[model samples]
Target: MGTNVTVSLKALLLAGLVVIALAVAYLVGDSRGTPAEAASGGGETGSSAKRSVTVGGTGEVTAVPDQLGFSLEVRIIRPDLQDSLDESGAAMDRVLAELADHGVTEKDVRTTGLSTEPIYDRSRNAPTTLRGYRVVQRAQVLVPKLEDGGAAIAAAVRSGGTAVRVDGIALSVADPEALLAEAREAAVDEARAKAEEYAAAGGQELGEVLTLREVSPTYAGEESWSEASLSRSYASDMALPIQAGEQELAVQVEVVWRLAD
Candidate 1:
């Protein structure tokens, strides 16, 4: 009996020790291995690793401006400032009438500048005598047909509104929003090419695009348009020379790409 009891006690103690050891291992494993397992995708396999680079590029596009903006002005000189202003108004009224006669719509004709300044005979500064008054008024004409542009100016000049002067002729795309999109796409393509080149230089192929952005659209105006404006002369029946040249667009992209091995 004593031998059997001793054997039973030994077995029980062994079993208890095994259970306590398992409990302690479970607690320690939960504390240390939780973060490592989660970071490793909570499985035996690990998650994908990423590497990347950034690059910059510039792009430009040239296109003829499709629309034109021209202005007509009438300046009158008189002995008195008010008188010059009145005469100037009368001339502009006549000009508008002529434009209406030529099928010009009210929307197409808009009055711009109206001002009266005292003319000073500074040539002989003998007390700065007021020679006369100069009254000037301006109007903008939106001409759709490039061919009719000259004829319209000639008609204004012959109408005795001889102060008929052109202010400026600006060229622009009619549908800027739509046309800018194509230019932006081109800019993006250029940027991608540059990125590829940069990636090759760094010994890595570009991976998935991390980010994309658009900077802003820009314009290049004709240089002569401004030069012709300052000179005071009516645009005659002679065809106005206009060259729109080109417009520029830009896009910026920050692409974080995984470098290839």
Candidate 2:
């Protein structure tokens, strides 16, 4: 009887010690976990405390255009669709040949549009009657030599006669990659200077760049001259003169800079 009683007492003591150990472990874990959670929250707050400013700047560069682009069309109106097509096709052939004679290669000329539509006679009382069919063949020509543009246009008109129509001519740079790079560099420099000005005004200094994004570049000073007036003048046996103006390439960028005390 005495041995069994002693064994029961030892078992109760062991169980109590186990329960106390578990409680102590849980308390220690909870104490450490609370501070960890607080530290994580404090980190988030610190991140939010960072200061930054955003600014935009623009830069522009102007250069003379080296390339000229123009559109020409040969149109014909006839009672028969086949006749209209034949006439327009012959006229276009002559126009292309004339352009070739003036140093405009076949690759430089591209057919932009070809369509046939019915012309309506609006003089009818009740319903409009079909007058004829009109066929138009349009092409765009790129003149690498700006000086040859006038002669190129004049040649096309002479080849196609009154049926040839010059839409318009625009001047632009053949390769704008270098110009764009210069504009971008200028834009970044302007942005940095503005950022510094602002930081100094606000009693802060500029730190590292937080973000940088370039806005899509834009082109200005692209002058397009209509050939309608010039065509009339050409009919009077006057010389056709073409003037290529300068083109302005502009670039803008938005930058975000961190501020330091």
Candidate 3:
């Protein structure tokens, strides 16, 4: 009887150990499978959440220019460098005096360029020889009043004589910051409107902006007068036919929006 009882007690202890081992194995398998199940669920959620659209839009505004800008150059040639420089300087002084007389202030006149170089005489059967020195000086003038540009050019030419050359002319607004701001606002509005359209077409409601970026603004239809067109002879009393046409300023933007129910 004593032996049988001892054997039964040993059997019960072995059964308890086997049950504990099985429980540990089941717990380990469950812990490992939970992460895989959660990852699969997360991937499905992420795929469904990534619903968005991107669009681009542009805006433009036009306005007339308020100011005129041009450059004038005086060039002279002489056998001596000093004489060439002196002649060019005197011519520039006369041109400045003329511009001042025509209501252009000293602050508006700026010396943009100056250069002196040797004139080489290259001819057949003749070795390269230095003929004389040439001196060139250029000034950029800004006329506040649009009507004064032609008169100023004519005066400069008369004072500087045949050596004077009108380089180029351009029309511009005095202040462009306000115009740029307006264009930016318009661009954003256009982008939002386009995004909404896209969302509606896709049977989704526009939720929130995911991202926004601005493309560099562009300007079109700005008038630039060519040198050849304005170089023709003009009388002192006659005004050069200058027409300040409209200038178009344009801005563009890119935006991304998320879609919702």
The residue ranges of model 1 lying beyond 4 angstroms of the native Cα positions read: 1-52, 57-64, 101-104, 122-128, 208-213, 221-261
How much is the lDDT of residue 126 in candidate 2? 68
Candidate 2 per-residue lDDT, tens place, 162-214, comes to 88888767888889989999999999999999999999998989999999999
Q: Which number leads on lDDT? A: 2
Against the unseen true structure, what C-alpha lDDT does each candidate score?
0.65, 0.84, 0.80
lDDT of model 3, residue 255: 87
lDDT of each residue in 1-261, candidate 3, tens digit only: 999999999999999999999999999876665554555443234435457788888878887787777888999999999999999999999998988876788898888889999999999998999999999998898878777777777777777777888766777777877998898889889988988998898888897888989888776544555555445534334556678788888889898888885
- Please provide, for model 1 over 89-133, each residue's C-alpha lDDT reduced to its tens digit, 9 standing for 90 to 100: 888888777666655678888777788788877755467788899
Candidate 2 — which residues are off by over 4 angstroms?
Answer: 1-48, 125-129, 226-228, 236-239
lDDT of 2: 0.84
Query: Model 1: what TM-score?
Result: 0.60
Give the Å error, residue 227, model 3: 5.3
What ranking emerges by lDDT with the best candidate at the front?
2, 3, 1
Give me the displacement of residue 34 in model 1, in angstroms. 27
TM-score, model 2 to reference? 0.76
